[model samples]
Target: MTAIKPVIEGTDITSVEVGNTTLKLKQTVSLDSLQELISAVENFSKFFDLTSLGSADEGIKTEWNEQDLTQFLSKETREDQIVALKVLSDKGEVTREEFLNEMKKLLKNPGFRGWDLGGLLAGLSIRSRTWGYESPYIKEERREGNEWDTFYRIKERYAPLIKKWLKERGP
Candidate 1:
């Protein structure tokens, strides 16, 4: 039979060993001692003032560190915008002005960082011709004679790469 290990608290015999069994001797513990033991068990089971037992501090710490996503807001990327546009377009058929208004409102949110622009555009451009806001500065960039063609070409190239990245990142 395996050797049993008894538990001692100072001079008090908390538990006794008989063959391979450990029998608890002090059934009525002091309030402080009971609270401590309960807290220790709640903190880490198998803790009976035994030096051989391990602590669960790391596991508890990790479990506590996970983010609470209920408070988090989803960010924007072209991909996300595109996807949003697609879904919104399918369900309600919003006008360009309405869509831009919604996008503007979404952009103002603290959590709405521009991350999924490609997906956003994929979802957005089908029913719309403009971004959320009209800018005199941006108009020059989209002009035919301007170097904005380079920017447009770059985005055209960006689609496939973005699609691949989003696929790897998952829905």
Candidate 2:
């Protein structure tokens, strides 16, 4: 496993961790892009602790990062999001049918296990229309499959944040 540390390059560029790799990016950013970058950094700084992010539970975990998970899943919808992610984390490659069945079986909340639950399964694009939310994990494959058949799986770029979160939070 690769390890990275804080590197001060120019006045702007800050190194980011892409997996265990150190990505030192120094480039010009458009005004809009700069703003977005600042917003993202500010948002990411809220975790209070980043040291234990991907290392604490490395023995068994996916590539999904905990910060990214929290950013995508709101408290109200986190349970649903976790259920879907958990299925992918366990099965690796799966279809929407498998996802739906696993969700029905894993979702502990009675109110969220309704037939309508599948619609918000991934909060992804449906019927070829954008839903404004796409998981870094499997956004394209988990689509409602209006344009084509669906395929789902955990993203390779992410760390094993899902399994760690579930173990810590229960179910």
Candidate 3:
């Protein structure tokens, strides 16, 4: 029998098959919905070693400051950064302006990094497809000041350097 090695990436899941009935899973699912999924695995257990399988561990971990304001948001190591941004954007539940304002505040902190920004931008790109008229990056910059006001300003100013980075590593 071939050893069934499982590899997980972000929320995406894949399974190797040594027998019939290939396994598959949708990356986008809630923890509460997992209980129902066990039935599927249980039925398949007769053929495969389901003993190694466990509950679906997903979702984010966010905290609030003593002042009752949000301090930080965190998610599973395997959780995609874009997924986290989607959660934040959903929870904020704001109009475009309000959302951008929130992003500006989040970005101003020294701790924010390119990964965070990329995630937000990527999420915004996805959300915009359905919501319409929301450019998280531009809006985020506006919140801080202007697209030319934030670090992106320098990025734009140094277009050649930015292009080099893009050429080496496409967005």
Candidate 4:
């Protein structure tokens, strides 16, 4: 990002974080008052060049791209993991049942009927023995109103990146 230095004296704007999901404005002023931050940014917004911003990781270790996807996933991988990535990247959010159905269809296995990937271990293919640290790409959350029913979601920023990559690197 092009750092917008405080040209106007007494302006305490320190940094501005631009993310795919949300734009986080960092400043020296108190965060209690959102209005002040809004006004402060409004005054100096013209000086900001948001075009060349940094990749929005959304807490992921690295940004999702074709190159990163290859390196990150090529090591010690699982078949289910790849299938899950494909499904989640396209679907965005899939409940346990929906996910299992997709898995069954993709894998072409009748045995997957009523089967479960269970915990993050299978859902994200978390291998403690490997460099993979509970995939930064996918999130597993327990669906409300059900204890066992969980849903998988590919982070919004990564969905399209994955979809594009998968398309290019076709089966």
The best candidate in terms of lDDT: 4
Candidate 3 residue-wise lDDT, 1-171, digit = tens: 333433333442333232333344433334444445545555566686744443221111222222221111122121343333433434433344344454555445545555665665556344433332222222222122211222221112223332333244322
User: What are the lDDT scores of the predictions, listed in order?
Assistant: 0.35, 0.50, 0.36, 0.55
Off by over 4 Å in 3: 1-111, 131-133, 140-148, 151-171
Evaluated against the true structure, the overall lDDT of model 3 is 0.36
The TM-scores, one per candidate, come to: 0.19, 0.41, 0.18, 0.48
RMSD per prediction, one decimal? Answer: 24.2, 15.2, 19.2, 12.4
Off by over 4 Å in 1: 1-83, 86-91, 109-171
Native RMSD of candidate 4 (Å): 12.4
Q: With candidate 1 superimposed using the best TM-score fit, by how many Å does residue 14's alpha carbon deviate from the native?
A: 95
Per-residue CA lDDT of model 2 for 50-169, tens digit only, reads 344542124333332456455444343455666776777788877766666777677754344435545665353231123233344553332231233457775665426655665666
- Candidate 2: misplaced stretches above 4 Å? 1-68, 71-76, 108-118, 122-134, 139-148
- Candidate 4 lDDT: 0.55
**Best to worst by lDDT, what's the order?**
4, 2, 3, 1
Q: Write the per-residue lDDT of candidate 1 for residues 67-171, one digit (tens) a residue.
A: 211111123235445444333433343433344445556566444433443334434332222322211001011212311221212123233443444444556
Q: Could you tell me which 10 consecutive residues in candidate 2 have the lowest summed lDDT?
A: 124-133
- Candidate number of the best TM-score: 4
Q: Can you list the residue pairs that collide in candidate 3?
A: none
